[model samples]
Target: MDLTTRCLFLLSCLCMLLAIDLDAVEPSYYVDTSSTSDVIDYKDPCKAAAFLGDIALDEEDLRMFKVDRIVNVARQTVQTVNRTDPVTGSSTNEAGQSSVVPNRRGLRRWKRAATSRPERVWPEGVIPYVISGNFSGSQRAIFRQAMRHWEKHTCVTFIERTQEESYIVFTYRPCGCCSYVGRRGGGPQAISIGKNCDKFGIVVHELGHVIGFWHEHTRPDRDDHVSIIRDNIQQGQEYNFLKMEPGEVDSMGEVYDFDSIMHYARNTFSRGIFLDTILPRYDVNGVRPPIGQRTRLSKGDITQARKLYKCSRCGDSLQDSSGNFSSPGFPNGYSAYMHCIWRISVTPGEKIILNFTSMDLYRSHLCWYDHVEIRDGYWRKAPLKGRFCGDKVPEPIISTDSRLWIEFRSSSNWVGKGFSAVYEAICGGEVKRDNGQIQSPNYPDDYRPNKVCVWKITVAQGFHVGLTFQSFEIERHDSCAYDYLEVRDGNTENSPLLGRFCGYDKPDDIKTSSNQLWMKFVSDGSVNKAGFAANFFKEMDECSKPDNGRCEQRCVNTLGSYKCACDPGYELASDKRSCEAACGGFITKLNGSITSPGWPREYPPNKNCIWQLVAPTQYPHHPAVRRFRDRGQRCVQV
Candidate 1:
């Protein structure tokens, strides 16, 4: 080879050596704290949380979650120590080699969780990610593999960030591997996957932290499943072993699983191989396999994550004969314009009994707002049970039909904690008998706040259902913004509303126009009073003959009585048997557009025109103009 060609090769080798030397000299992770101790550095997502001092979980907030361990930084610096390879009989010097991460690695104890404190489930199970430019090609590939592992076992999908408001940025910094719990809305989260931290299992563990699962050993029930050895832990890391309170963390009903990928290794945080930290409890059943297997996700890990994120089963869909489901962001505000529909079915003959754990939604006195509507069957044409809003949970709803299709909807303006409900198909409840009485949930006692309940009373065919509230006392409000009861005729909500009674007064005895009657009661977030109780009995509200009110367009029957009525846009003629429409007049549903009769063509030279508009009783008719610009046409007030 020529000398010049050989020189170029040597120069390239020199550059490579220089890069390695620089990497070896990098400083260990360190933090400069402004306070002396336990000041709760909670405000910084970039820093570990200082000890919050024995803040045990309280009974009232069992649904709330909080992590006790911080992304702590051990206060030491890495120094080289001599190591001998037993197999090769060779000597080498390695920096901070130990069973657990060296005390100097600083960033410690993976923390990934968001207390119902303040979190919302990600939409569509997608998580956007970012990678710092400094990581080498090999390191970047490890990050991708970790993410793909999660995608393979679960519905979670991770993509590169592009103008996203929140994302995880893979950064190669001084801190040991660590990631902020769940979403911290203020900005992007930085996960430190530093040098030597890219092992498959370690990378997967850090990614788990980003998705919101706490370390398996930290679970409150860990004691029943595993024994924690305290003496083996590194110094000043007592906070790292703190266990969560019962219910403070949810495993999505998964059994204690030592095989979970979220489980810490037996020697995690230990000073050396002789010291181990986690041991699975032994039982009559048998001993279990070792934990901290970084190979892939365990069954419990995948199931819990799927349940927490609202993917498919677990809690999202209820196909079982008896089951329960909650809003998408349970224990948190459901997002705006959110729509979730659930179908519940029972055996060929049984009916469904739905009970609410809690319900809080945006409120509007006019009913022009967020609501959860229930139908007797799966189609849109199926009868609507009732429309409910406000902060209150509704009373228990019973369906005479064997199936129920429930849909939850939220408008764009505001949102609340939404609702949580459970339904079980009953073999023989009160409604199954066709003639029975119904009571408010927890009758004779103050109803729980934020509740919604519905009961469908059905009588045999050819007979009508009569209902009366025996005892009633709901929070008094002119519009019932906080709590109220609605009764409807027939099985659907489209059935005519008989009465929307609230206040302290008992409603008068009423009878249904058909064989079925639906009763729905809702309560707000505050001020729940003793609710009402109603009795159901079958009777006929039928007519012997049909008569168009002396001869008009139509006639209606009201249990033993009849009345005549004319369709909209027409009025009874002088003879009462005929009808006439005013010039340019027509009738339309509440949601429709109106235009001049002449349309896009020219009108006759001399003709006077007038029109009338009408709406359902719940929403009084109002003149609408200005800002109604969908048609690109001109309109004027008559």
Candidate 2:
């Protein structure tokens, strides 16, 4: 067999043994890196013109321009058969892969050759690009997938070019995959996607360069994390491993991330097939970290990108039951001319309690400059609880419902340490005290929609609950259906109803028939209004008024109502109200005797007799009493 046939057969066999599907293998696997063999060099007018070194440019400019060179397929193995087009000096390999010659006219503008320079970022993290018609349908899909991978993790966005002055042009020229670092001011910068460069990760890596990321190994602090093996590195490619000065690159306060997609594999730029140009160091735990992961953006990479673009740590949506949030750059004076908003939401039927731990901001009488505004609702238009500034921390703010909106604004003139705050979800409970106050969630302020809160006020038995409304305003409804406060006479919802109050009308005093009172506030998923507030206290004794209990004799007051009692010589009648003459009396002396009504004669029918015997000491003496009746009636002793 010929050398190519033998190579293919061996590779197919190896794939089968490894359980790898060769058909599913990405074209990046076909990269050729052998320096001994000749590879096709696609000559282009742009590359040649720049290589000629225009007479207008001086020595240093040319050197820097040379360092800004772009390449396709950064690091890969070499194994290919090249078929060159003699006329154009351009050729495709056995896998139909070719190299792209970047448009070098724009390279003259880039001066930082070895630094991880923060090149001009896309405005607002919005990038405009145009995909060349030369790409096949599937190839276009790969490009989109890579773009989406970056967008999914970071705040960066990619859109088709419109009339923007600066945009990216995705071109297919049979060149290796490559892209310029950061956005170029030129009219149309090109990101070349060659034949074998259509792999998802390869495209993603190239785009990382476009998004202003340097190789991970070039980080200033990389030496502490990775060790470079100079002996294994290719002789002329040593510059690729050089580290940037500490001040030149920004790590965004993140530690070294070995899994960054921008990182090179251990074998990158190796002098031999089996040589490794880079080796990871043991961590504090004596464990080595894996490197060169082209699967997705690393946490460090995402953080750095976000920091460069100022996309996060500015505003967020908080939904935890309890959490804390602060202004951007809190405790370290915030940036000038900044605006940030935070929306906090907890479980429904609950309320939010926000507490400011610290506050330091530019002081203004009207708080028109740098200040933080808090609202009882979830939007900008929500009722503003307060707008605070200066060194004084604001009072604790409680929401009427489960959501709160907080905003921070800073003027271009002054800034301070900003503020810090924490929040938690709070809601209904049982109030069993003698007298206290009860109000709707976030009463005075507008209540939130779609919430139900219950409050059970229970005092000592026999004491009726008295509630008086100080202020009342709810979502107006004729039937008190949308949003209303329902008061029941007992502790449970099934108790007898006192009243359902709603709208702007204030309810009269509520006095429960029993000591327990049940209150439930219900709000639908619609409009909201300021809820009601009321104070509850123990009402006066029900039997305090003269003859209030309708008793024919003495009256006694209980917790919630009244009762009747008979005098010494009288008995309680069957009607339970009238008092009748009785044969019993309280005997305070040493001894006493009692008899039935109309004693010596036959006692009246159905007459009740009673007597009380008492002694001054702890031990009391017992007295005997007898009752006499007519025929068939028996005499009983007490």
Q: RMSD, each candidate, Å?
A: 30.7, 35.0
Candidate 2 per-residue lDDT, tens place, 497-531, comes to 99998877678878898888899988988998767
| lDDT (Cα, tens digit) per residue for candidate 1, span 274-303 | 689777778535756688888888888777
Which candidate's TM-score is highest?
A: 2
TM-score of each: 0.36, 0.37
RMSD of 1: 30.7
Model 2 gets an lDDT of 0.62
Relative to the true structure, how large is the alpha-carbon lDDT of every model?
A: 0.57, 0.62
